[model samples]
Target: MTQLTVFGTLTTLSPFHMAHAGVSAEIDQNGRVRKLGTGTAKLPCTPTYKVPFPLSGDLAVGFDGTVRAIAEVPCLPGTSIRGKLRRVIAKRIKRHFIATGQLLSREAYHCIQCGAFSGDGIKANLTTSAEVIAADQQLFTGIFGGGPRLFRSNLRTHDSYLYCAETEATDVLPVIPETTALIRAYQATFAHPFIRRDDLLDFLDPIAPDVIENYAEAFESWQNTVLVTQERKALDRNAALEARAAKKRGEVVEKPEASAPTEKQKKVMLKGQSALEAVMPGVNFGFRIDIRGDDAQCGLVLAGIVDMIKEENFGGKCASGYGRMAAHLRVMNERQEEFPFLDYDGRKLLVGNQIKSYDDALESGLSQLTSASFEAIYNPKTEPSPRKGKKTDDHDDDEG
Candidate 1:
């Protein structure tokens, strides 16, 4: 199988944030806030070589060196890339092509609701859409993603990072008393070189019983790398939140609990936490794409990436200015030969063959997603009527 590596840096135009699953976030009986998860602090992800410096901020100076740490998204997940690129390409199709309403291909043949595309269509016996997507369409499956495959090389992403200097300033800027305390907390993991591997979990998975347990010591040596917050506005505290974004739409926005920082805790805030965590503009994090596939498949990926660079931003807080990055896509083969997709300035994909700069692909993509399939896919059953039966003359009606 042939492979190509496209590597570049995600130079943040703004701060990025992603709180992973294992992060410990809690408030004790003392009302002190402790948030443990910050993806950048993970032991497996930290880089081997680092040029440590103080947490660069007006407030970072207060925290003792032992606790000063920064949090980052660590790596840009492949799903994020796939999803965003899908949307970008889909949107372009919608913008220049698709009109008011058009239906799209539904899930898979296994569906009790839909079974048109697959060979065996019996609703009673289901063969999942996931299976078909993986087998039938390599463009949808092989290039971007689909179901898993054996003996196959597809696309993958590398993690990004935080470029924090030292963790000196502890005093949190724009100190908002309680709401900022959690950000004020710090979690540190051991960052030594011997135990770190960019793909640690990949090695640990499906635990090998036959092989001697060699990594136990290395795993035990792992510690919580520190997480420090620079002084920052309590976004939840001050914002009208309702006007901002109601998170789960239609749900009431929860208010931030009032936390009174103790003198000692206040010093931590004075040190940093509420201070900062976002990889502000001008910071650069590494990003790479590894593709192990054929030329046409590689072209599809390159096209999607070009759209991502020209029109999209990766990572969190893209709603604001954060996560926007410049990606230079280069195709590197096993022979160490590199071909820069420099022609793809990321503006648009050229339609080849019958479709020219003058000719266009007939795109049937659409915005009207809430159609008949909405109910078939997953629609909530309506609430039962308040009244079971019609009112009778004999029954007295309730006051209006």
Candidate 2:
């Protein structure tokens, strides 16, 4: 939406180069030459200005005959836009002149920073173009709502430029559902147009439609699995608690009651028990595995056990540490599909009771353990060896 203009000798520079300078000027207005000042002793002589222009008004013409004036031009958004413009100019120059062996002046071939092009000329140009392209790809992809890292990477390297450019060139393209929703939401909230529909459709079409659909479906499926799993776990836990309470009740009965527990008596007993019982014991009481502690005391003790199993190589024929832990924990508690707590030190700490996978168990265990506990467990008693003095084979052998 921003704009700037550059005035320079057309004979001396390419139109693309002029365009690049114009874009830069728009972004950085300070680059424009404002006034004709008196030349100092070190660089003596220009005191002139006010010359007749071919069209409209008088132009500020220096003693050297170079005219300076503001030219009207449109610019891309932000610094990245300037960089891309530079890259486009550089690429065009390289392809038309440099690669074909056309002779160019030192001024024409000079690097802007060093004023020379003696080393890695082609490589430098390519690298600059690549970097700029990468940045532009990232910006455009973000504008589109979503994109893959690989696709973005390829776009930057010119590998996917044709595909992206073609999409950009199209009209009335299909859009992703998420992107469409986002556009609608944005329009509703802002009460103004921010992203053009054409741009949205262009970006969306390049990204495979099926990939987006599948990703959405997969995410929903995972959410459903988690919800169902949690429900089933709650039901099983409630049944287990009820069974334990019933057994305790049976043991407490020393003799058959003179009268069986009537409905009123059962209601009274249940109310008394409810008053004493704590709701959500899991939330009220929990343990942590301190991974950084001695014996590797962890937030979840199950993870700690898994760590032990792995270190000892003790879980039958299974080579994977995770697999071994899952197997061993399953044997200990048939109801548990995996260890709920990760091993910490020699014991397993409770992380969660319904973790269904080893990965989840490990994560839950680590989270429960506090940083202070970790420091107490794993913090070295001795000071670390100085970097300069470290030279022993034993030092090299240490994993830390």
State which candidate has the highest lDDT. Answer: 1
Model 1 agreement with the true structure over 1-400: per-residue lDDT tens digits: 4576776444445455443443333233332233322222211221211222334444244344443434322434555665676665445433432354544434421221221234322322233576444433343234443211221226675544332222114321211122111222122212211222223323444454345366665543431111122112222222332322454356565673333434444343333322113333444444567876545455555556666776646655467565566444445677888654532222443322311111111121122223333223322233333455777555778846
Q: In every candidate, how many clashes are there?
A: 43, 33
Local error of candidate 1 at 141, Å? 2.2
Tens-digit lDDT string for candidate 2 (271-341)? 22111000110010011111121111111223323333334222121232211111112212222232323
Q: In lDDT terms, how accurate is model 2? A: 0.25
lDDT (Cα, 0-100) at 242 in candidate 2:
47
TM-score of 2: 0.14
Model 1 regions lying over 4 Å from their true place: 19-63, 67-75, 90-103, 108-137, 145-153, 163-276, 342-400
